[model samples]
Target: MRNFYSALILLLCFVACKETTSGKKEAEQHVMPSAQAVDTLLKEEKKPAPKTFRTFENLADTTFVRLADFSDGFAYDLRYATKNNFLKEKVYDCAECYTRVKTAKALLKANEEFKKSGVRIKFFDCYRPNSVQYKMWKIVPNPQYVANPKKGSIHNKGGAVDITLETLEGEELDMGTDFDFFGKRAYHDNFDLPEKVLANRKLLKETMEKHGFWSIRTEWWHYNLKAGSNDKVANFKWNCNQ
Candidate 1:
């Protein structure tokens, strides 16, 4: 009887030990999954945002569109809206870059090509109302400085843009001169500039030309879209508070 009881107790002890080990392993499995699931959810929350672009199919080629609504990649430092420009007065109620659909399309393609070289277009000016052109004419009245408001500038026609190259990191390229710097230093034909400046201007000019844009001999920063220059000059304005 004593042997029998000792054997029975040993058996019970072995079963209890086995059960404890199994229970521990099962608890570990449950705890591990919960922790891993929480970690995965946190990672998902930190993922990068999806890219967004506006649809342009419905818009007419001549229709003026806000460039920002189409793509967020381009940069803007609209000069006429502030006193920093040669005008020395804020002629616009706000700074907004608008262009015709065709011009915008060409610009978008040019920007894509620019991105391949780690650069992008930064606009100094865009579609200007004839009224704003008149204001600029009032300041300088020179046909050379401000395009005659009566004839209407390519800007008023939504065909031209004054722009420069900037890196993806927002550093401006050495284009030798600032936008609207009415001097020989700002001319595309000027070759006396630093090599880097010439190269930068070359890249800008070539890429724009390939995209149906033509640069003026006098201004390195100005580009006119061939298809849009014939469009009617517009006096319509954009909403400033929007």
Candidate 2:
């Protein structure tokens, strides 16, 4: 009877130890995943929010601002920033589009109108600094082509832009000649071209005019804001590192 009781006690002890081990393992399985999930949530919470475009509210019309910061709706080529321009030299350290607040406003409006026609404005240049004008003058040295830096053209005043229209897919519309083409083919008055090119030029001209921009007779791509012409010429340069 003593041996039988001893054996029974041993069996009980074994079952209790097995149950305890199984319970510990179950707890570990649940706790490990819960801890990992909590860690993932914390990482997600620490991440920064996505960036967004800035607004022009409360900013003075004369204030210079980067166009990309205001809206991502427009396109940029910035030819002078590269060697693709008439100067055939990379004049800018980096590509950027800056304009006076009023000019940006007019461009935004004009772009919106262009979008309605299934196209958008692509900028070749905008708000050229007075210093850059001087560089361009040294390269070209032609009053008819490069504006005299000393006299300060409308571009130096942060009001002028060289632009073209492109389809929503980014295919450039034919405007007869390339940008900075110093010839009759680029003339706004030249109508002896294909119907499509003429229509494209007409669309760009009429829309820009409606938004208080006036085109020069010689260059099909150049447009100056009528109000922006009075703004003082600026030599403010954008930071290329940014």
Residue-wise C-alpha lDDT for candidate 1, range 160-192, written one tens digit per residue? 999999999999999998888889999888999
Mind giving the per-residue lDDT tens digits that candidate 2 earns over 67-184?
Answer: 9998888999999999998899998889999999999999999999999999999999998899999999999999988889999999899999999999999999999999889899
| Model 1, runs deviating above 4 Å | 1-43, 46-51
Q: State the displacement of the C-alpha of residue 229, model 1, in Å, after optimal TM-score superposition.
A: 1.7
After superposing candidate 2 on the true structure, give the runs of residues whose Cα lies further than 4 Å from its correct spot: 1-50
Give all TM-scores, in the order shown: 0.84, 0.80
Model 1 alpha-carbon miss at residue 161, Å: 0.4
